[model samples]
Target: MGTLDEIKAALINLDIPQVQCKIHQGLAEGLSPSAILEKSLIAGMNTIGSRFKEGDFFMPEVLVAAKAMHTGLDILKPLLTAVENRVKGTVAIGTIKGDLHDIGKNLVIMMLEGAGFEVVDLGVDVPPDKFITAIETHHPRVVGLSVLLTSVMPQLQTTIQQLEPYRRELYIVIGGAPITQQYADKIGADGYAPDAASAVDKVRELIARN
Candidate 1:
């Protein structure tokens, strides 16, 4: 495999040490931080995401792969901080109240951070008031809402309504197994991502349009 693909493979196999070594080698070989991130780490996680959706992989596999990806990210994050590498944007994300699942939300965080967006994770079981507070305090370019249960989907609308005062200033994106594009549109959300990989693309596209 090519060096970049090797990074992806290491993450797929959940090989953290290999991921660390490969990422360092990529840097030593003069590859840009963003290139390693987008082409390797994030791309690898995209594969993991597909496997997860297909049931070839489960939560344990995804969690371990996320750890492997982070091993590489830990090494490269400092380089991305260089003045020449300005952050692409900022995001605040969390699961709505009554939903305790956070594995998907954490995956999105790694992917967003890898893609060079400064992400502020609002954690699981977050109330609409907390999301409102996050927007007011962080002044993020986008806010993401995650819901794992269809029963709690109403909280998504409630959270969006609470943030309506800042609607013109920040974009709101939603996701989770229970969240559909139609539901997103129904709630008047600015965007909806089907998975973590697409979340990166969606966030970037939304930011670019504004």
Candidate 2:
């Protein structure tokens, strides 16, 4: 198999040490870091995310694969200088207020970073004011909210309400277990992703439109 394919397989296997070594070897062989990320790390995570959504891969499998991806990213991070690391756009993400769940949020952050966007993760149980502060401070092209609990859907609404003034220029995306496209639309979210893989695609689409 090709180097990229080997890297992808290693990532799926959650072989962190091997994945890191292969990424280094690929870089030495003149493979671009961007290519390695897109073809191997992102590709593998996409597969894992899809499997997870389809119930073919459980949380443990996805978590391990994500860990392996982080290992490879550690090796590539230094090679990506400030200018090279400046991707298509910046995205700020957080789990909405009063909701502490973060696994889904973390997965989306990883996928976004893998897709080349600089991500600012605001962590879980974030309030509307925090989102507003982050948007004002970071000036990101897009913002993402994650809410796993049905109880926290109102928090998503509050965040969107707080962001409506800047909604014309800022793209807002929402996701998590209880969030649906209908709920996203109802809450005035620009986009909704059912899973991490789809979140990558949705963010790309949002950036393209912007």
Cα TM-score per model: 0.92, 0.84
Q: Which stretches of candidate 1 lie over 4 Å from their true place?
A: none
| Model 2 C-alpha lDDT per residue in residues 92-140, reported as the tens digit of each score | 9999899898987887887677667889999988988898898889889
Expressed as tens digits, the lDDT of each residue in 1-210 for candidate 1 is 788988889899988888999988888888888888888988888898889889999989988987887778788877877733788888999999999999889888987887779999999999988988888898999999999998999988988999999988899999998888999999999999988889999999999996
> What TM-score, to 2 decimals, does candidate 1 have?
0.92
Instruction: Give stretches of model 2 more than 4 Å off.
Output: 50-58, 80-87
Q: In model 2, what lDDT does residue 89 have?
A: 86
Let me know the TM-score candidate 2 reaches against the reference structure: 0.84
Clashes of each: 0, 0
Worst 10 residues of 2 by lDDT: 77-86
Q: In order, what lDDT does every prediction score?
A: 0.89, 0.85
